[model samples]
Target: MPLPDIKPGRLSACQYADNFSDAHPPLTHVQALIEAERCYYCFDAPCINACPTGIDIPSFIRRISEDNLRGAAKAILEANVFGGMCARVCPTEVLCEQACVRNTNEDKPVEIGLLQRHATDAYFGSPGAPMFKRAESTGKRVAVVGAGPAGLSCAHRAAMLGHEVTLFESRTKPGGLNEYGLASYKTVDGFAQKEIEWLLSVGGIEIRYGQSLGQQVVLNGLQAQYDAVFLGIGLGGVNALGLASETAPGVGNAIEFIAGLRQAGDYATVPVGRRVVVIGGGMTAVDAAVQSRKLGAQEVTIVYRRDQPRMPASNYEQEWAQHNGVTIRTWSVLKALDTTLGHVQGATFAEVHDINGRLEMTGKHWELAADNVLKAIGQTLLLADPTATTLALRSGRIAVDDEGRTSWEKVWAGGDCSFGGRDLTVEAVEHGKIAAYSIDRALGFARHDTASKRTRPTPA
Candidate 1:
């Protein structure tokens, strides 16, 4: 393909080491304590309402103020088991932090995400015991597909409720996006695997790796074999740009590229171009652009068809990318890729204007030099055979009710593969938790457990 521009070893060892350090380093003990004091702990806290998992924000902050790290972790985890990972990746500036009452009075919200991270990190660092005890065995078996946030969360909650869980994962490791899709800087120090290991310490959950849906695992067989089946099978396919040159050698999926970077032993081993262009308007695009810069790419540009307000990524994420030297070109659409011998060399883009409320491209077009291109456009759900599965689907994903129950009996689904999924880690965790209780009820198990009182998913 003659792609010489994309090469590894672009930076020195020190530069590589510095580039991948924790994107947001942990708060010091004093910093966390001080941040905890900033909270008013209102009785009707808006922050709690903003949390997708409905975590008790004021109560957790109160626990932190009392110097009870474990207690604080408990309050957070009872609602969201993946609190550690969420604290690292969740869009807090728009969610909980934005909803803080202090934002109204002082224009500064208490650092809830950082405080939660502070407590969760301490507990995970020396998590000797699981917080919740397993109830008497219910003899109910749950087959959870996809070991990403949703499936793993479902598995842990089911196990905690005294049900045996077989977690089916397509890849060798668990923590789907956490392990494979998240930016390296956002989750440094192998935190994804560490969180998963601590979650598995609860017992009664077995993970079957390399077990992909429709390949090694099938829905019909799972329904017959298990008491309840929870499908967290995340979006397996990356959406493609319809342009012809998108197939060039230098072009790639942003998620796949990020996954390779995440799995690589050393940052220097991953190849990056001197000038790279990414196409999309979401967190995946932002991650790809920022990581490309960190990997020593001289120039990185993110081109989105829509303007700033319509971007799926939070305003904080957009600013983060810009801070990392990424050029965000809004109202721009990718026109074509310039290729040399089947290898990408550059891209052409068109500026669009909202005419009659529709984005119609202007006649002028411009080109940017590049050797690498990434498409973070979005993802798609892949069912083994769309016709073979009787489960109802909506908007190209499995349809589910509030409890995550699908139309099919003995089956529930959540995560990005399900309709109404917010594509946020916290929301996915809540989906698993709610579905676990629903599964518990469907199995005719005793409903005297404390988790029955857990809150439902809410708007961010």
Candidate 2:
């Protein structure tokens, strides 16, 4: 049966299987051991410092060398409960691997990402051990909106602190972007859900699916009912290309396209165009274009409004998309769409150049025959009701103090919706963790109880 939205691809189902499988498989025990031994084990490991969650790299790798995988996982999860997912998506080349001492000598760094995955997998595969025990009931409750990396981290840490937690997710399935926005190739075998399940297993965290912050539930109600509220609702609205003909058939947002693929049980039925064109210079664009090619699109092209160096996607990821047979055209801006039968058939583009630091078309124009076009430009923040709260805003994002507290007291915000933070999952996790600690401290100080931070280790 043909899917109404998708065109048949050239590859067989088996080929799709190979292409969509995990981008980097976890290291085997021997491989992990060999790689762990390569670590110079610097007293102050730069890899650990590079990590956003700050997991003790040298300590965890040392435990792995000793074949104590559980200990290593505990160390990792202690810092970042979402290390497993981070291992799959983090740009190690820009983060940990780049800081490895070996990179200075041989240009080949220790496989830190794979090593982290191995440790986390070992613990996940084994029987449950109480890595964290819930604190005594604090008679406090926290409400978290959105079940993405940041929301889950905040909820879990809050629960561990003995505060009841309720996570409201707008999506039917929890695990926000992890369950939706990520590339299927990076997250195989439905690992996103598995991580969600593991995180919820910590207890005292209740999840309400299909519950949105502003629709089913209101932010003010949560603030009134719960002792504190954390908002981690990620960017909900896809940024429009400002180009005409966006609503035509065969046109979609890259985030939505990936989300559909992420939720689909069968990739073959996911509609892909024969000639797909993606517009953007970010990871979403690369993901959308590469997945299009993997789904058997004969020709997939990514058009960016700026040069390749200006692309937000990492160089490693850009090269990976190219290797996957996705053509990348930079310094080009989409002008308009050519449609037939009410569906997009091609697109016109203009050569773009910087004029006085502003982008301007140079009048050079061309058109590509595109059966479909995905807009991966980016996303925008959608507040249920902006006027309902006193939340400060900087450039349309929720402005927060250093502690992740918004202008509204007892209400905190983090993740992509909050200003002054990276949108990466790891950074989101950090934001949530920091916010959790801030909330915990505020509550702690009120009761005249001085406990260590909710997530991080006690200071010297």
Candidate 3:
């Protein structure tokens, strides 16, 4: 067995700088104006229906067209507190843009995502007073665990409704997945932190960093201290490759790699293998593979157990990976790792087939040469002590009702850690928003008569 050839400075300084730049550059004012005019501003827009956060897509675009940048930003942020971040990271091509009416006449839809970024960036660039103000103090306090989209959304909304919010975060900096899990290129220039600061400007919300749920703070303690508790602690456990090389020197979780890349002061200081192999088919896999290539990996491959259509990553993301020179090998299940001297050199996989809707290995085996292997199969929720709380679970996720009320009273959950929703940032924001509304009602805040008017299908 030999040691892996993993080290920093795989790419030159200039290459590293270019490779890690923003994946989607913000549109110039003129470009944004032209794109905004492309929107028809339909009275009954399907794009709004497609948005997970129910952002008034047409209204925002209309404002953009009218050069009402601040108003457009307000429209978007009023619905989704994380509008700017989502505009950069969301798979709008499959969601809002896919449902756009313009897709009927022209194959392409309006650039809703870019338009969104234009509006939000304009507002954030030249910030004014906070868009929304907190209500009079209600003398009620809430504890929000996790600083990801869901928790932040919940905290912001609850605070706006006059509840004091103490947001608990495990890491030194906030923005859980947005800050750590996403590819560095997707959120270039420290946008996640900027968005967090913007959201916090509404006031009445306090963040306690270096505080994790299972460790520094416990569920029981939070319940006793706060009038209500909202858990947005996203999946904290990474799925293993279940192979002997899982802990090999060159083998690591893709999330950790991305987080390191995000936190790296200099991109050239981050180590990347010349040949990298990533397992799984979700956004994490694509992100790791693409970033690996950008980090100067000569050959990068993403191996998925199922076919392309079944991939958790959207078609746009898959295409983006391929465009960036990432090889996509589907119908392959990881079987073993070829290791030497406690380091991963490559991986062995068995070609699989769908038989009666169940994946079965066909006994056909192959290998991909690699100096690094990233496990991006999935993530799991790691509760500090399940017995410490009586919250019910569904398929290992916290089970909550439509409004995010958990089995335990005075407790709510949302985001990836909760049941019944996709792991998209926008979906998590909606969950947090709805959960806050529910919590507000429980705490004697008058419910809007139109609260029942909004509806969205629960994500399975």
Candidate 4:
């Protein structure tokens, strides 16, 4: 049977709006003070240690306690130019708040993300003052590819050093995945573009839309013309499910699906499914499944080949999905698709078990009556120009040294496409920031080896 007229429901709209609304609303004056007071303000705060950007967490919170919002905002933006977005998207329960000293004694840790958002929002409400300004022009130009978190961070930092930055983005707009890849509800209120506008307001940065890294733009020409180059090109390709699947009406990639939903001004018109099966166990899978259920899917299930412990979605995310009525099925892999009348009708799965460190699909299989199937297994790295360049690789990613310097000198890569990308926007911002510092020092504008300065132990 072919499913018809599946779209977001009114109840789903209500629930999605609630779940995806700004994760942390700006704290009220009293709320910020109370949260700041909870902080011990330790000499060496573990919360700072836990953050990838290493924002002076304690100092900012103390400033908030003192009602110095502008100072707090400056402290944050100094370390992370995208502090507002990070405050909205970062997994605070696992990072900063997890390391709070109060967490050891009291179950409730200070609301660090909220406090940070409160401070940063206050600054963005009026960005004309420009919390930080650039040094004198260095007469050096950098070509930054991709305007995502990493590219934007690198571009902003490079601009701060008085270096000219021309950012190339493939899409019509900026914000990369933050604008397109994220769940729409998480970034409601057009905050992603708003933050990007604010970040660029610092000056020294120029963006050219519809210019891709390799397809439309040439890398060699960029390398020859620019004084330095930062490749924050994110993963552009979506991984296949490896099934003999058809390009039917109901088969889709979770990333593109989520991107469509995020970009849609009218969520009610977005097509959904009556019964949707999302394959994989990562955050993407959970998000797709939960969102499908919210989008009027009568039955939504997540199928993963591995056990729950090996699932990539964090416990908080998994729980959030389950709380929203998403069913999780482990130890199963999508085997084949069932289609009818130019539309997807269902899918087949094989039972799998990890034996001798390898996943094996047993002979046993089952059928699922899914009107739509989404593949959320993972993403693939589409090198903008795969044939022309010979970029080194570490574990199937662009190999980079400590400073995000790729094997090809003068061609630095960061963000998801680069090796060691944790696939989080916050981590990507850190990558771009570090790469900017490294590029600055390499240009002889800075004194020290920026790459050698360790913020934390090398991540394994």
Q: Pick the candidate with the highest lDDT.
A: 3
Instruction: Kindly report which residue stretches of model 1 are placed more than 4 angstroms away from their true locations once superposed.
Output: 1-3, 386-388, 446-460
lDDT per residue (tens digit) for residues 1-460 in model 3? 4557788888788898898888889899999989998899898889998998889999999899899999999999999999999999999988899999889999889999999999999999997866898889999999999999999999999999999999999989989899998999998888899999989989999999999887899888888889999999999998877776688788899999999988999988899998999998999999999999998888999999999999999998999999999999999998888776567887889999999999998989999988999999899988886445667888889988888888887999999998887799998998899888888998998754223545436664
- What TM-score would every model get versus the actual structure? 0.96, 0.94, 0.97, 0.94
Clashing pairs in 2: 6-271
> What is the per-residue lDDT of model 4 for residues 1-460, given as tens digits with 9 covering 90 to 100?
5454355553556665665566435778898898899988898899997888889999999999998899999999888888998887888888898998898889888899999999988877866566778889999999999999999999999998899999999999999888988776567799899999888988999999999877778777788889888888888788887666647778899988888878888666678888888988887887688777666677888998988887888788888778878888989888888775567788888998999989898889998887778889888778767433687877767888778888776888888888884688888888898889999988997743545654323545
Question: Which pairs in model 3 have colliding backbones?
Answer: 1-340
In candidate 1, which residue pairs get closer than 3 Å at backbone N, Cα or C atoms, i.e. clash? 148-176
The segments of candidate 2 whose C-alpha lies over 4 angstroms from its true place after superposition are: 1-10, 386-389, 445-460
**C-alpha lDDT values of all predictions:** 0.89, 0.85, 0.90, 0.83
| Pick by lDDT: 3 or 4, better one | 3
lDDT of 1 at 377: 94
TM-score, structure 1 vs. true: 0.96
Q: What TM-score should be assigned to candidate 2?
A: 0.94
| Per-candidate RMSD, Å | 1.9, 3.7, 1.4, 2.3
- Tens digit of per-residue lDDT, candidate 1, span 44-141: 89898789888899998999999999999999998899999999999999889999999888999999999999999999998876687888798889
Order of quality (TM-score): 3, 1, 2, 4
